[model samples]
Target: MSQSRSRVIKVHANDNVAIVVEQGGLAEGTTLDDGLVLTGAIPQGHKVALTDIRVDDPIVRYGEVIGTAVVAISRGEHVDETKVRLPQAPTLSDLPLAIRPVPEVEALEGYTFEGFRNPDGSVGTKNVLGITTSVQCVAGTVDYVVQRIKRELLPRYPNVDDVVGLNHTYGCGVAINAPAAIVPIRTLKNIALNPNFGDEVMVIGLGCEKLQPSTLLDDRPVKIYENTEAADPDANVLSLQDESFQGFGEMVEGIMAMAERHLERLNRRQRETCPASELVVGMQCGGSDAFSGVTANPAVGFATDLIVRAGGSVMFSEVTEVRDAIHLLTPRAVDESVGKALIREMEWYDRYLEQGQADRSANPSPGNKRGGLSNVVEKALGSVIKSGNSPIVDVIGPGERVRKRGLTFAATPASDFVCGTLQAAAGMNLQVFTTGRGTPYGLPMIPVIKVSTNSTLGQRWHDIIDLDAGRIASGEATIEDIGWELFHMILDVASGRKQVAADKLGIHNDLVLFNPAPIT
Candidate 1:
C-alpha cells in the first residue's frame, strides 16, 4: 500500500497484526502474501489479521497490545468492534521519568513574527484596553460597561479595539480559599498580566464583593470606578457623569478624553523582530475524529516542533486524549522533577475523578465515538500526536502564566472553550486549533487559526477555519508540508491578515463567567 501512509510490514516478525492505512478496493480475493486473504472491506488506519488470533488472545500493534479479539480472527481478516478492543495503559507516573531523546536536527532560522513588544519584554498580538469585572454580583455591570464605550463611544473612534469584559463563575459563591475560587483568581491574574494589554486598564465593580478590583490589581497602574450610583442602579452604573444627563455627558467626555491618550499611544506601536520564544502558541483540538491523530494532530505536532526548535513556546493540554502516549512523552522529560510533576498532575486529576466528582470516562464525547473513537484512552493515544517529540520543559495550571519557553504545560479547566480563550489571556499571541469536526471559537484579542483533519470538515467550515491540514488525511499532503504551511500562517495571521471566520463572524469571543462551585 502507501509507504508514507503506513510503516507496518508483513515480514512475519510476529508483531501480531498489520495496520491498514488506506482502504480502497479489496476485490475480495486480494491477499497479504502466504495464506492471509481478505475477508471484508477494511477501514483506513484499522488493523488486519496477520496471523491466526484466538478469541481471548490480545491483538497487538506498534509492538504493544491494542485490544483482545472477541472471536477467533483468521489471518488477513478485518478487525473491528466484534474483534479487537481497547487497552488500558498506566499513566506516566507509574514509571520513573526518563530522559528525552537528544535532538538531532538544526533549529529553524529563526523565522520571527511582528508583534507588539510590551515593556515587560512580552510580545502582544493586539493592543487592547482591558475592562475588569470584580464579581458575579456585577457580571451584568461588566457587559453594560463595554456597551457604554463600544456602542456609544467607539462609533466615532475606530482606533480602539472594543473593551473586553472579564466575567467568571467563582467570584461570588465560593470562598476565596476553595479550589474553585483559587482557579478563577488565577485566571483573573493571568488576564491582568495579559501581554496584549495597552498602557491603561479601567476597572469597574460593585462595592460589596469579596474580591475587589483594586486589591487584585495591587501593583498594576489602573483607573478605578464604582457602579453603585447609577440612575438605574442595576442597569446603568454610576459614573463620573452621574449628576444629570448633561453633567454625565461632560463626565463621559472627560473619561473619553483620558482614554484617547492611551489609544493614541497604542496606535503608535508597531510589530518588530522578536524571538520565536516570545510567541506562545496554544495547541487545541475539538470535534476530533479518526483522521485527527494521523493527520491534523501530527501536522500540528510537526509545526509545533518547528516553532519549539526555533525557540518558541507551545502548550498542548486536553489530558484525557494523552493517555496512550504518556510513555512516549516520558522520554521527552527534561529532568526527573519535570517528569514527576507531569505524572503527579495526571494522578491528581484521576483522584479528583475517583472521589465521586467528574469522571475521566466521561470524556470522548458522543461526537468523538460517532467519528470512530471508542473511548477516552483510544482518543488520548491519538491526541498525543499534536505535540511533536520535544523536551518537557514545564507545566502550569489554568489562569497561570506560562513562564518557561520550549516547555509543555497543563492548565486546569479543561473545557475547550475556556482553555482556548484562557491561552490568550495567559499570554499566547496566537493559537493553532486542530479539529476533525469543526468549531467557530476565537478570541477577543488573539487570532485563532483552525486546522481541520479531513477535507470534509475543511470545506464545510472554511468560513471560520484559517488553515486546512486535511490534505494529510486525504493522502494528498504530508505532515511536514502541512506543518510548514501552518507555521508560516501563524506569521501571516500575526502580520494583519483577517482569517475567514474572524472576518465574517467578528472575533474576540470570550467571557470569564463561571458559576461559583460551593466549597466542599
Candidate 2:
C-alpha cells in the first residue's frame, strides 16, 4: 500500500492510534496516507500508533484511554495487546445521573407488522409450543418427546411454528432457598410464559425434584390446557415417575398427548396486524472485532433509537460489557431512580464476580484480541453502542420481565447463550445479534437476525450472515443507511415475511442458565 492510497480509521480527533483499513493489512514499511511508515506488518483491524509513546503513556481509542503503554513504543509501530496495560475500572460512585439532553427526534408512526397477539396483551413473532422441564433429569425425556411431537403432532398443526424443549441445568441439587436462586427460577417460569408460546404452559417433571413443577408457576397467572380445552393449571404437569406410566412408551405417549393439546391451541392462532409498539427486540453482539464498533454496533444503535422513537421496546444486556461503560449510561437514564437501578445491577454483578474470583479483565475472548481489541475497556466502549442514544427508561435484574418501554438495560451475563435465554425470559420476541468474527447463533423460540461487521466475513459466511454493515467501512454506505435497512429487516422478520440465515440453516443454541446460587 502506498502513502496516498493506504487507508485507516481514526474515531476521534484526539485518538493517537487508528485501525488499519486495508484488506489483508499493510505490509511492513508501507507508508500511511499521513506519511507515517509502518514499522512492522500490521494485520487488518489492528491498531497503528500515530506518534511515539513513552512508558506509562495512555493508548487512546474511541477518545477513551483503553489502556496504557507497558513499554516504550515508537511511532508507526503495531499496537497489540502485549504493548498495552489494562487500566482500573471506573469506581461506581456519585456518577452523573440523567444529565445528558435527550435528542429531539420526531415520533415515528404507522409502522406495523403481522404478529400473534396473546391473551396477556403480548405479541409473538412466532407461535411455538414450548415444553418446560422442571429439572435436568427430565431433559432427555423432553428432548425425546419433542422429536416425537414434531414428527407426529406438528404436521397436523400448520399454524404452529415449531416445538421447543426448554432444557437447562438448574433444577435439583441446588440451593433453591438461596437468594441467588431466584435468577434461574424466575428465568424458567418466565420463559414458559413467553409470548411466542401463546401462553400454553406445560411442564414435564421427574415427580420428586427439589424444584417442583408447581413451584415454578407459583404466583403467576398461567392458563394450561387439555386437548384444546382449558384444564386445571395444577393438572398441567406430567410426571415421568407417575404410576400411570407403564413404560418408556407410555411416558412418551403421555407427553405427546399433552403437547398435542398445546399444538391444537397454537394452531388456532392467526397472525394479526399489530403496531410496531408491540415489538420487543433484544440487541446483542458476539465474536466482535474492531470493525464491530465502527460498523455493525453503531448501525444497530441507530436502529435502536428508531425503535424507541416508534414506541417499541429494546433491551441491551451483558452486565460486564456495560460495567466499565456504566458512567456513560447512568447519565442517559430517564430519571435518577432509573440511574440508581442501573448502578444497583452493576454492584450486584461486581460482588458476584468477586465471589467467583473473576474480574472484568477476563472478558474480550481470544477471538476479540485477534480482531484488534486489547482489553475489556475497549470492548465495553464498543459493546455499549448497540444501546444507541436513547434515554434508558428502565433497568431490570436478571430473569425479571421487562416492565417499561424504550431502551432498558436488562442486566445479564455476557455469555451469548445465557444472555439470549434471559432476554427471551424478559419477553423479547425478536433479536438482532451483531458479529465481526461471525457466529451462527439462533434461538428456537424467536427469530435472530445476524449482522456482519465486514464484507469479508459476510462473503465468507454468506448464507449465515443476514446483513453486512461492512459497506460503511468501505464507503459504499453510511451508518444511517445500514440502520434503516436493519430497521425494515426487523419489521419484515417480525412479520414472518423473511427468514433469517440462522433459522434457514436450522442452527439453534441451547439455553444456558446463570446459576449464581450453590449446588449440592
Candidate 3:
C-alpha cells in the first residue's frame, strides 16, 4: 500500500483504483506518489483510475471486483458508479465452509471494567429500570409518566441511572398472530432484558391493544403482568385503560407508583469489577463514503480483533450490505453448521427482498453515491471489514439473542435505527457506529461511540464524533494505534469513568421495530 501528502491511497497491489484523501480533492494534472498524473478532476473520497480501462473491464478495489466499467476510461480519470455497472450477486450454494483456519489470537487477560451484576449472571454496564410499553397507544402516556418520574422520583434514587421508556411503534393494528410476528415479539422481549436495564422490568399498557401488557411480561425473569384473569392477578402492571382509572391524573399516578417500586429496587444495585469478556458490543456504519473501508472501518476491524481476543462478543449486521460478499464470509465460519447458517440468512433475505419486488441494488443511497460508493458490492467489501478476521462462531436471526463469543453475524436491515434496535434486542450493551457523511445518531439505553472516516467530517463534527479515525488516512496514526485507542475507550465508557459524545449531548433515536407482517 502506498500513501503520501499527495493524498491518494492505494489499498492493495491488485486494486486498479485509489482513493483521493485531499480535503478538497485534486485538480486535473495533479501528481500522485506513483507519479501517475490525474487525467481530470477527482473529488476527495472518490476513486481515480490507476490505469487505462476499456468497456466491460472490472473496476477492482480492496482486491475485489467492485463493478464493471460501462464505457472506456483513460488513466487517472474519476471512476464512479455512473461509469460502473453493478455486478451479479454472489451465489450462495456450494460455498466453502470452515476452510480458513482461525488465526491464533494472543489472549489479553486481566482487562476489566466496573459494571453491575444481574441475577441472570449477566453484567450490566449501566444500572437503570426500564419501563417497557406494550402498544403505541400508551406511548404518549408513558412518555408523560417517564418525565414525571425523572423530576419527582429519580432524584431520590442515587445509585440508579436515568430511566428510559422502552417505546416502539409495534403491538397493534398488525398481523399479531402471523408467522412473522415472532420477530417483533421476541425482539421486544429481549430488549426488555437488555443488560443495561438491570432486570427491573416494568410495563405500561393500554387495556384494548392487541399486544397486552400480560403478553410482554408473562413467565419472564421480571414479570409485571396486567391485572387480568389470564395473567397473575397479583402481577403488577400500569394499565392506562383499566376500569379503575377514571381520568388522566389517576392513570399517571398509577404509573408513578409502579415506577417508584422499580426505581427503589434499582437504587440498591452497585457497580462491581468485571472482566472484558462480559461486554457485548454492536458494530455498524451509516452515511458511508469511500473512505469508510480505507480508514474508519479497518480501524474498527482491528479493535474487533482485540475485543474477540479479550473473550468479548461483537455483532456485525446489515444483511443487504453484506449479501454481495456472502461467499467470502462462509469460509471463515467456525464450522459447517455455522457456514450453512450464514447461507440460510443470506438466502432468506434474498427471498424477502424478492417478495417486495426489489433487490440489493436499491442500496448505496444517494448519500452513499455522492460519497463515492459505486454499488452494494463495493459497500459490502468495506462493510465486512468491521467484523475483523475473527471466525464466525454463530449466526442468529433478527432480534434473537447472541449466545456465543467472538464475531457473530446477526441478520437485520441496513437502516441505522432498525439495525441498532435489533442489536439492542440481541443484548448489546455498548455500540460503535462509524460514518463518513456523518450522523448524530444514538440510543437512549446504550452508549454509541461514533467514529469519523475522514478528517474533514471529524473536524466538522468534532462534538458529535467520539473518535477521529480519519487520522489513519492522514498518515498521522496506524490502524493498530486507533484500534488500541478504541479498545481502551470502550473500557473507560463501560466502566463509567468516561462518557461518549452521544451520552454527553443526550442525543438518541427512537427504537423502530422491524415487522414484516401485514397491517390489519
Candidate 4:
C-alpha cells in the first residue's frame, strides 16, 4: 500500500493514468514513479496522463477501463473531460458470467429474525402495515386515511403496529412502461405481497388514472376503497363513500374494527432459519470522505461477499458514481459481454447527462464537496465500494426486485430516498447505508443500519447514525472486524432489535419515486 500524500494520485496499478488530488498546485515537472510528472497543476481528484496514447485507447482504473481516451493523449498530462472518454456496453448474453467455487464456511445456525413471511415467499424485516397509493394526486387521500386509522384504531389495537403512508410521483408521463415507472410498480408489488401487511389493505384510488389499484392486484387479494363511488338513490346516501368521504372519526372506527382481528393473526407468526439466499441487502453510501473506499466501502464489500456466499444478493445504484468505480466490477461480469453491457449502461447515462435529464454536479453535492470530494468523478470513484466485485447478474430499472442472486445489479434512476425506498419495496429485509457525513433516512418496512465513514459525523449526529467506520481511516480497526460487527448488528435488527438511531429519531422514508412521472 502507498502512503497518503497531500495531493496527486493514480488509483490503479496498471493504468496509464493519475489523478490530481489537489488541483492546481503543482511546481511543474515534479517527478513521480515510472517517469510520470506534472504536465501542469491539475485539479484535485482529476486525472493526469501517465503515458502517450491515441484516441479510443482504454483509460484503466482499479485495473479496468472506465472509458477510452477521447482524443490522442500524451504522457504525464491531465486526463479528465479534456482527455478521458466513456464506453458503451454490449448485450447481456455476451457478457461474462462465472460461478466461482463457493467458499466453505459454516452457515450461521438458526439465524432467525422475527419477521413476517408473506404468502408469496417474501420475508419482511419490519412489522409495518401501510396504505400505498400509486400517484401524488392520491397522496393526500392516503394521508387522510392513515390519520383517520391511527387516531381511531391504534389507540385500542396494539398489534396493528404502525400505519404508514406509501405514496409518490411517477405513474404517468412515461413511454408507457420505461424502467422509469418500474420502481413504484414494484413498490406496489411488495406492499401487497408482504406478509407484514394486514389481511387486506384499504386500497385507495382516484378511480380514473392510468395506474389503477385493480391493475396492481394482478393475482393478489385486496379490499378496495374507491374515492369515486356512485349515488345510492333509494336510501338517500351520498355518492362517494371512500374513507376520504367519511368523517375522520367514522373512518378510523371502521379501520380499527377491521385491524383488531388481523393484527393478532400477524403476531402469531414467528422467525425461522431461512438461508441468506432469502435476504436482499440494499447497499448505499453518502456524505463520503476520502476514507469511503478504503474503510467503509470495502468493509461493506466484505459483507456483500458474505451474503452472496450465503446464496443471497446485493443491489447498487446511482449509476454515475458506479462509472468511476467500474474497474472493481468488470471481473464480476459473468463474461466479456456482461462486462460490455455493464459499461454500456454507464455510457447511455453519460449521454443522457449531456441532454440535461440529470446533472453531473449532483454527483458530488455541495454537502459532498464540503466533505472533501471536489467533483462527480472523484466522488463516483469512491462511492461504489459496497458491491464487492460480485458477478453482474442483471440490469434493472428502478423499483424492480432482485430475482437474480450472487452479485450486484445496476438500477436506473438515483436519489437516496427513492433508491433506498425502492429497494425495500422490491423486498430487501434490511438496508445497509454508509455515510462519511450523515443521513437520517430509512425505507418503510426495512430497518436501515446507518454506518458513518468518520467518527466525527457519527458522534455529531449520533441520533441518526448507527455505526462508525471512521476507524478504518484512523488505522484503529480492520475491515474484517468491522464487517463482522455489522453482520451481527444486522442479525440483531432482523430479530426485531431497533437500530438506536432510527428508533430515537423516528426516521422513515416512504413513497419516493422518480423519472418521467407525474407529481402524484
Q: Which stretches of candidate 1 lie over 4 Å from their true place?
A: 1-53, 59-66, 70-86, 91-93, 155-159, 221-223, 226-265, 498-500, 507-509, 512-520
Summarize candidate 2's per-residue lDDT along 17-108 as a digit string, tens digits.
88887779889999876789999999988999999989999999888999999998899999999998999888888899998888799999
Show model 4 residue runs off by greater than 4 Å. Answer: 1-112, 155-160, 170-183, 194-202, 222-264, 273-275, 335-362, 517-520
Report how far residue 214 has shifted in candidate 4, in Å: 0.5
lDDT of each: 0.65, 0.90, 0.89, 0.61
- The stretch of ten residues in a row with the least summed lDDT in candidate 1 is 229-238
- In angstroms, how far off is 378's CA in candidate 3? 0.6
The window of 10 residues in a row where model 3 has the poorest summed lDDT is 225-234
**Candidate 4: deviation at residue 437, Å?**
1.7
Local lDDT at 149 for model 1: 64
The TM-scores, one per candidate, come to 0.83, 0.97, 0.97, 0.74
Deviation (Å) of 77 in candidate 3: 0.2
Candidate 3, 250-287: lDDT as tens digits: 77877777778778888988999999999999999999
| Candidate 1: tens digits of C-alpha lDDT, residues 104-172 | 768777687777788788887666766656666656655654567677666554545556666655444
